[model samples]
Target: MKNRPFRERMGFALEGIRTGWRREASFRTQTMLAGCALLALLVLRPAPIWWGLVAVTCALVLALELLNSAMEAVIDLLHPGIHPSIKIAKDMLAGAVLTISAAALVVGVAMVVATGPAFLAEIGL
Candidate 1:
């Protein structure tokens, strides 16, 4: 697989994204929320640095989510049984995803708070 062409590798990644969108509710939800954050950034026109910060946070969340989903799938395929070690591993994966998600939320909130006056003025509030 490593020897495959770059095009093939990108196609595989796209397929994985499609699978996540179709099979994982959390992935779909996070993707939508991330889209909203990006939309907010577009509308608000915050600082240039903020664009990078927000984009990175959103990408981190989706990437972590995909990693979490891929690992859980592997665990299920290999074990398919209840075990303490597997449970802890799964819990840690969940915790990691949750931590990044929370960080993304904080970055989003900070962006809004920093742009509050401009946002309000634009919205006629």
Candidate 2:
């Protein structure tokens, strides 16, 4: 099959998210959390650059999780037997998701810390 263009690839990715949101509890939870975090960022009015970092990092983690899920699905479809190579591939992809999630958490905390004082002050705390 010919490689899909970038726009087509993005469309497929959006479709995956739509399907996942309907079927996957974890995806729904993460999306809900992302929505909450976005609201906080807007209400708190964090430094513009830090807000961008947090938003991008959160999106990256979610995107990585989606890709990891797709990888596992393809591996299972290709080889239903117990295969060390397939196990390794799936584990590595999962590890990538973990790493990205951890990084996103760190960035998110940093953004909150950087802006928390101002937010509190504005609230008359």
Candidate 3:
């Protein structure tokens, strides 16, 4: 197939986002969590390295989720009925998501703890 123009490519990407946001609760929830993390980062304004770690962790979680969603869709299309191998594949993908999410949680918590009293003060709590 011929390569599409940049605008068309972006439109297709946006459509994917719209479809995922509408169809996948996990996607929507993760997106909200990421947004909150970003807001926290802005408020905390930690060291430069911490910013990079947090950004990468958030991106990794979101990207893994999109891949998992795509995998589930393809698997369902190919195997509508239950099958052991299909179940394993889906389970592994979910496991990968869980692993990354846990990593992201760790990064987020570490940042919060490292910020310590300043974080609490920043929130005026």
Candidate 4:
């Protein structure tokens, strides 16, 4: 796998994203939020650092969501029955998503706070 060509690896990665989009409502929802954040970045015209922060944070959140979904799918396939350990694993995955989401939210707010006034003045507000 490590020896696979970059293009092939990318295709596999994209397939994972497509699978996540199809099977995970949370992934779709997070993707939409990321899109909205990107749109805000475009409109607000924030500093370069804010752009990087928002992009990286959005990517991290989305990537984690995908990982969570994948892990849940595998767990379901392997364990098909309810067990305390499986339950805890799934719960922790959900918790990870929640934590990243909160961070993303902070980035969003800070972006707006740091750039909103400049954007408003630019619009003669």
Count clashing residue pairs per candidate. Answer: 0, 0, 0, 0
Could you say which candidate leads in TM-score? 4
Off by over 4 Å in 3: 120-125
The 10 consecutive residues of candidate 3 with the worst lDDT sum are 116-125
Cα error of candidate 4 at position 117, Å: 1.2
lDDT by residue for model 2 over 9-110, one digit each (tens)?
999878999987776666677778788889888888987898779789879877887777777778889898998898899889988988987898888888
Instruction: Give Cα-based local distance difference scores for all models.
Output: 0.95, 0.83, 0.91, 0.95
- Cα deviation of 83 in candidate 1 (Å)? 0.4
Candidate order, lDDT descending: 4, 1, 3, 2
List, residue by residue over 81-123, the lDDT tens digit for candidate 3.
9999999999999999999999999999999899867878878
Q: Between candidates 2 and 3, which one is better according to TM-score?
A: 3
RMSD of each: 1.3, 2.4, 2.0, 1.0
After TM-score superposition, the amount by which residue 22's alpha carbon in candidate 4 deviates from its true location, in angstroms, is 1.1
- Model 4 spans with C-alpha error above 4 angstroms: none
Which residue pairs of candidate 3 clash? none
Model 2, poorest ten-residue lDDT window? 21-30
Which should have the higher lDDT, number 2 or number 3?
3
Q: Estimate each model's TM-score.
A: 0.94, 0.84, 0.88, 0.96
Better of 2 and 4 by TM-score: 4
